[model samples]
Target chain A: MKIADVETPALLIDLDRAEANMKRAQDYADAHDLPLRPHIKTHRLPRFAKAQITLGARGITCQKLGEAEVMADAGIADILVTYNILGTAKLDRLADLHARIRIAVVADNAPVIEGYQARFDDPDHPLGVMVECDTGAGRNGVQTPEEALVLARMIDAAPGLRFLGLMTYPPRDDRVGARLAGMKEAIEADGIAVREISSGGSPGLYSAHETAGITEYRPGTYIYSDRMQVAAGLGTLEDCALSVLATVVSRPTAERAVLDAGSKALAADLSALPGHGHVMGHPDAVLTGLSEEHAVVDISACKDFPAIGEKVRIVPNHACVVTNLFDSARMIRGSGVEETVRIAARGCSQ
Target chain B: MKIADVETPALLIDLDRAEANMKRAQDYADAHDLPLRPHIKTHRLPRFAKAQITLGARGITCQKLGEAEVMADAGIADILVTYNILGTAKLDRLADLHARIRIAVVADNAPVIEGYQARFDDPDHPLGVMVECDTGAGRNGVQTPEEALVLARMIDAAPGLRFLGLMTYPPRDDRVGARLAGMKEAIEADGIAVREISSGGSPGLYSAHETAGITEYRPGTYIYSDRMQVAAGLGTLEDCALSVLATVVSRPTAERAVLDAGSKALAADLSALPGHGHVMGHPDAVLTGLSEEHAVVDISACKDFPAIGEKVRIVPNHACVVTNLFDSARMIRGSGVEETVRIAARGCSQ
Candidate 1:
């Protein structure tokens, strides 16, 4: 099928640009001597993860066990689940996956450790564990270096777990790096060697090297730079590879047009940037509003508005959430349609 | 499977409450002399649509061709697609479904009419078409009464198309009803009978009776009232039948607990009621933040914060969007899992 012949409200990925993006990030990580473990939570496509691995990615990072299972099913062996696995059902899945591949998990609290201890206390084959540090996002992780040491001690003391190192989601801020370094020092003072310190954030990818004692870097959004990345000064709009191919279904007025893509397609992730997304080729147009199935566009300032049934490409505000909204995405290489690839981890939100 | 063992971050629907909510709306529409065309976009389940039919709905409403196709496959013979059918691919599907079911479509532009004329100009099998009016939502539809007349004339002029009447998404605000009524009067003055004036919106479902000449009413979210509906004064929290069963994945501190449900599960639809969602039992707790995989909750104000791994039910800000996030939803009867129903229309965003 031709790219133009694809249906409206569909996900379109520029394969060439995506490959280039992968190479760019890999090159940066190589130059800084950092092993790039790209997070699969962004694309959720094992094909892209394999492409990244082919381009020299160390492994893959998944935010959920279900995502890791899908990635492993795709024959990608090494996986890191960067969230706490608490419940028995999830722990059983984690243990099963651990037996199959090199899997590592992160924890920030005692109950999480206790759950892990109860399920994964087999001394024969130990599970790698990392302590999550609350650098600044304030969403997850321990508050202080002392708390990190406390969790590290518990992981190292566990019979079936090996204390791998420290990990933080957005190791963007310098303070986060300094805090990780201090925690590592405190952890080593207690006679436990920190083998790996992982930090991840696309907006702060370049800053990953500046963070002291970080050995591995993970970046999800770098594969598909979004409106947020561009606004965060990570890269230009030209670096964005993923775009939603939507048709102007209705022109309510001269100043307004409605695209088939809405929150269900483009997602409701409002970046720090103003509108919902950037309408490619129409610099003056802004996605003023979004209903479930329609994106209300204000095209009054455009030099020329698109006609009804005209297809328009949109770079969504947050590519990660948008990628998860679709079941599959059309792979396009310079206007030529490749094949449609199922997002193997699209609804792996467990 | 038992409801407690179903899994965390799952979509749960109270079947009893849903039946009650459906009956409540059906009773109101019957009393008001309006044919209730319950939109299938909320539950997107054939079971619920059939239940609504059993409870006295005239037909069902769908927003996309894909959804309508699913409903048709499930023996729903009468379906109204409330979206403009453009492009050959979608039009082919629409025509195919129209051949099998009593299907009606809406249009507000010439290109849309031209597409319909090209395919369905057969006088033998006329297609029911409605002129969508931009009453007040300003999303899609013709701007004025004259524009509605123009579309109505075009529909009436087409050999294969029958002009049904008018339709608006949100029948809220007195001005919208006045405008719609005026448009109906003007269109009828042009010698074309406006057989039906369809108006929809759960927030304005009760007030739909106040509209001077609306012949049909559609409400989707009434089957599952959400936090947004409550804040809009549509109903109370008790009226909400759908809730996300999310587990506390992590408690980084006594004040903060991370839920397994995030934007992927609960959605990013902000409510006027404040916070991401209403934590059912923890009235004082606030869902302060959400990422792709986790919802950061603030439980400082709560007298008793939930422990790690504890499950909590949450009424999402928008129930319709949340329904689209999952592949299936668990149906519960008084806290016991009755069955798991597949969201047959999920990813039917095309």
Candidate 2:
């Protein structure tokens, strides 16, 4: 079936651009000597995860145990869940996943490490526990290098756990390397080997080499560069591989029109750019507002305003969130659909 | 299962509060002499939709054909899709759905009506079509009452379509009744009978009586009031039936903590409130930001900060979009879960 045959407000992933994106990131990481560990949170499809592994990605990074479980079920051998896995129920699943494949997780606090210590005790498959440090990005991590050492030491002492490395969702700055290096040295000075210095962010992917001491790069959004990534100097609109195919259902006024896709389809995240997303081939038009099922666009400056029922592809502000919005996406080779792929780990947010 | 037994970052609907909310809306509409056509976009569950029907609702309103199809399959005989149903594939689906149940659709443009006219020629199953008037809301509607008459006349003239009424997502104003009355009179003068004047918005549900011309009220968010509803003066925090049951997975600093529910779960729709959501029992704590799988909370003013592993219930800014974010939700009575029900129409964005 063609684009018109499929329903509107569906996800369309350009295979041509996506393959180029994968090869480019893989090639850059290979040249820079940084082991690429692609995060499956962006695509969430096992097809794409397996493709990343085939392209020489060392392993995969999941945001939660639920996501890791989907990847593991797909026969993904090595997985690293980036969040601090707390609570008994999730830890139970972590242990189950651990028994099957090589699993690693990050911890930012003592309680999380203690919970991990209680469940895991196998020497043969000691769970690699990494210390997530706050090297500048203020999301989830220990505040200082001293705190990283404390967690690293605690993880090293646990019989079921092994101290793997230091990880950070680093700020896009030159000092990211120095900040991560400080934590790595503090932990290594205590006799624990800091094997991997994992730093990640799609915006900072090309500048991975500048962050000198990082052993691996874990960029997620590079696979489908969006409007947000373009705003961050990642690439142009041409490099974006994913878009929401929407239909213009209402033309209320000469200057105003509404698309079928809204916050539920295109998502509600706004970038530094003007609108919530970039409307391809309609540069003059701005997406003024979005309700649940309608995206109102201002087409005052448009030379040719879209007629009612005209299909338009919109590149969302944030690509990762959009991936989670749909269960399945159309893989497009040029303008034709190659296949429909399920986002296996879409809502696995444990 | 109990609240603690379920995993983190899941949608929870307090069944007691939800039933109370349903009764309140039905009772209010009965008292105000307005027929209640509850919009199923907020709940998206057949269980709740059937409950609403059982509680004296005239019919259910759906935002899309896909949502209507789900409700129709679940034994809901009467459904009004409050969207401009365009395109051949969707019209084909509409025709199939129309043959099964009593279906009505709204349109603001001639193109949408023409498409319906071309496919539907069954005088026995003539499509019920309504002219959607702007009436001061800038979303999807005809600009003026004159334009509404044109569509209404066109719909009346079609052999396979009947001019049912006029509908609007009206602006919260005292003049709503007058605007609707003007449209009704204009259409009636053109030799077409205007049977139903439908107006919707949970914010304006209480003042629905003041809007003189409207015969029906379609309040969606009243079933699960959120921070947006609270901001709109619908109810207090006690009336909110739905919330994201999230776990505090990271305590980065004394002021900053992170919940497992982020944009993917809680969604990124911001209300008039200061934050993206209101955390139950944490009045001072603010949900400052949200990534895909992490909600950053600012708890500086809190006397009791949530520790890691503590489950927190967050009432999102908008309940409608949050319902679309999940596949299933736990129904709870007080704090205990009754059952898990699928959001049958979640992501049914045609």
Candidate 3:
């Protein structure tokens, strides 16, 4: 069915564009001789994850254990959960996922290491544990190389855990490779065998080859580049595949029009961009305000503002958060909706 | 089951507090002898909607046709959908709900009224249509009372529609009541009987009795008061009934710790507030940054900071958007997870 026939405030995915985005990122990783492990947080669809694997990704990366479980149900053999799985309930599920597939996880703190070591007891089939290094992104990771070595030794000494190389959500600092390389050397010198250094960020994926230490890269948002990616200079606006198909419900004035898609659909994530999203074809339309179900668009810059009942497409600021808001998405192949795809792991933030 | 056993990044609803909050709003409305119609957008639960009605609410208000349909399925008799229902798909669903129970929808434009008129063709059971007026909210509404009357005449002229009265998402302007009061007189002077002047806002629900024109008041977030409401001086911190129960996943530094709940859970609506949310008991803690799954918190103001693996409850900036993020919410009665209730209309933005 045409997107027009579908309900308003619905998520529209341009599949051809997404597939091309996938191939582009995968090709870039392939050219750099880095195995691409696309994060499933962007689309949250098992079909897209499988497609990425088909396009030569070594495996898939999930941010949460719940997401990994969903990917595993789709018969994905290799998975990497990029989170510190703590608490009894989560660790119990982590053990279940570990028993079935070739999986790995990352941790930066001692408590997380202790939790992982306590869960997995079989020394023969040791679980791969990567020491998350901060590098420069002041989010989650060890601060220094010495701290990385400390965590590396903790994992290597554990009977059930093997020390995998460093993992970093590389900071904006271009010297991230040098930092990880230095940390890897320190950890290896301290008697832990470093295996693979994994680093990722969609904004700096093209420069993967320049980063010396990392063996593989995980780029999640590459499948559906959003306005955030465009602002970060990662991809052009045409590369964005997902857009909220919303109808202009109210045009109160020539300078202002309200769309049905709001914070609930578009997400209120202002990830480095000025507004909530970018309205396609209306470069001048600024989404100045977003109530729960209404996106108030500033149409003063547009010579001819859209009228009520007209459908407009909006590319959200952050694609990953947008994926978590909806239950399903309409796949647009060529010009029309091919099928409706369930966001099987939509709210898998556990 | 204990709440600690429940997974992190879960939406928590304190049933006892929510019930008290409901009674408080209902009592205030009862004292003023005004009909109270609590908007279901905040909770999206028919059980709670029924509870509000049980406590002497006129009916429940909804923001979408899908939400009204969900409420109707749960035996809710009356619902006021505060949105301009446009397009064929939505109008079809609106008609389906109108056929089942008492449902009224608002419109600010001619296209929406035309859509309603074309679908609803029975004057004997004419659909209730409120002319949404833009007093000062600058969102979805007719520009002036003149525009409101024009839309009111359109609704009155339609054989299948009846002009209910004036409707306003009562803007912050104190003269909103006077503006709408004037609109009511002008429309009535033109021979169209104004039945109900529906006005709503969570922040100003307590002062609703002070307003002149509104015959009924609709307060949504008061049932599950949030940080935004608290900031707007609507209620105290103890009055907030809903919060995102998240885990402290990473304590990267002494001054900074990260929670599992980010924009996906807490929402990014900085509604007259400084941070993403208010970390209960940690008034000094500021939510500095929000990635998709990580909320970077600044805890420099605390004497004793939280550690990794610890759970913390956070009241989001906006409760309505947070409700839409989760598939289900854990109902906390006293100190535990009483049960999980499906957010029946969570993603029902259509």
Candidate 4:
């Protein structure tokens, strides 16, 4: 189906472009001799995860157990949940999942590792635990190399938990490579051989390849480069494969136009991005504000603004969270709708 | 279930409090003799929609056709979609839904109405068409009384379209009364009667009683007051029954703690609120930043912040969009987890 045939405010994914994006990342990993574990949080569609694996991805990384469960149900055996599974409710589910699949989880605290140890003791399947070292994003993970070793030692000594390796998400700094090398040295001094040093970031994808001691990479939004990615000089508009197809519901003035898609369609993630989102084809128009059901587009910068009822594609600021906003996306191939892929794991954030 | 037994990053709804909130809105509408058409965009849960109708809501008002379709499937016959339905795909779907149930849709542009008229030239059911007049939101609606009259005349002349009345969502200004009066005078000049003049806003719920021409009031977030409603001084902390139950995953420093819920769960809507979301019971703490799976809380103001692994409830800035982010929300009656209500309509925008 053509763009006009499809519903407005719908998600459109170009499969050809998506597969090409998948191959580009895979080829880069192959050339670097690094294991590519594409994060499924970007698409949250099992089909996309399968496509990544089919394109030679080693495995997949899930941020939550709920997301991992969806991938696991689709017969993805090797999964690494790059998050701290906190409570018994989640730990129990993780242990059950571990019995059927090769499951690994990351932790920065001893209590979290101890909780995993207690649940996996004398279990049917052993659990792989990775020590999360903060190279300095300041979200989760151990702060220093000394703190990383302390958590690594605790995991190595704990029953039912096998110490896999070190994992870190370094801050946007120039010394990330040095910090990763230091953390790796600290772990080796504790008599723990680091097999998989998972490092990630779309902005630091190239730097992560150059960084020493990083064996695996997990980057989610590399497939669909967004406004933030473009602004950071990471990717171009041509790299953006997914966009929100919205119609101009109201043209309040020549300067302002309202689209049917709002915060619910295009999420409110302005993390490292310059603006809310980029209006495709209208490079000058800025999505200045958004309500629940209306997006305020300032077209004063553009020589010709779109009239009311005209359709426009929007490249959201952040593609990962934007994927969670829609239930399904229309897969487009050669300017027509091919297949509608269900975002099966869209809101499985338990 | 006790608070400790519940899962982390789950949506919690207090049934007792929800019922009370529903009753309060119904009682206010009854006392004022106004038709309470509760907007279902807030919860998007059929159970809550049914509860609203049972508690004396005249009908439900949905913002999208996808939402209206869900309500129709749940046996909600009387429904009003307060959105301009554009395109043949959406218009065809709207006609199909109108045939299946008692439905009405509002329009502000001639092209949208023309599309609706072309698709349903001889509709199976009379399509209730409300002329959307812009009160002051500057979103989707006609700007002046002349525009409203022109659209109203067009609706009257169009086949298979029943002219319902006027609908407008005013700004935060308390001048909704004067704006509705202007639309009323214009409609009377054209020798047309408005059967239903619907005026809506949770902030303007009280002031709507002072408006003369408004026969129906549609307020979506009255049942669950979010950070926006609380910041608007429309509701208190006690009135907010729905919250994102998240666990503290990391204590990065004495000043910052990262929770499991982030933009994915809490949503990125910073609409008219001081911060991303309000942490329940921690008035001083503010959600400063959000990554995909991490909600960075700046609890530096709190003398004794909760330790890592502790659970905290977050009343998101925008409750409507937050509801759209979850697959299902946990229903809690009194002090126990009653059941899980499926958010079936979520992500059904296509």
TM-score of every candidate relative to the true structure? 0.99, 0.98, 0.98, 0.95
**Model 3 bad stretches (over 4 Å):** none
User: What would you estimate as the lDDT of candidate 2?
Assistant: 0.90
Model 2 C-alpha lDDT per residue in residues A202-236, reported as the tens digit of each score: 99999888877889889999999999899899989
Complex DockQ, candidate 1: 0.86
Ranking by TM-score, best first? 1, 2, 3, 4
TM-score of chain B of 1: 0.98
| lDDT of predicted model 4 | 0.83
Which rank order by DockQ, best down to worst?
2, 1, 3, 4
TM-score of the A chain in candidate 1: the value is 0.98
Full-model lDDT for every candidate: 0.90, 0.90, 0.88, 0.83
* Residue B132 in candidate 2, Cα distance off native in Å: 0.6
For residues B1-350, could you state the per-residue lDDT of candidate 4 as single tens digits? 67567787889888887788888888889999898999988888988889899888888999888889888999898899998888767787888898888889898888778877887766445688998877777777887788888888888877788889999887877666687678778987889877889989897786678877788999989888777877777768888888988998888567888899988888877765667888888989989888877898888898777777888888888788878887788988766888888987786564
The pairs that clash in candidate 2 are: none
What's the i-RMS of each model? Answer: 0.9, 1.0, 1.2, 1.7
For candidate 1, the docking band is: high
Label model 2 with its docking quality class: high
DockQ of each: 0.86, 0.86, 0.79, 0.62
| Model 3: share of real contacts kept | 0.81
Model 3 TM-score, 2 decimals: 0.98
Question: Can you write out model 1's per-residue Cα lDDT over A1-350, one digit (the tens) per residue?
Answer: 77778998999999888888899899898999999999998899989989889889989999999999999999898998999998888999999999899899999998899889999878889999999988888888988879999999999999999999998886356587778888889999999999999999899887778777889988999998899989988788888999999999999898999999999998888856678999998989999999899999999999997899999999999999998899999999888789998888999988
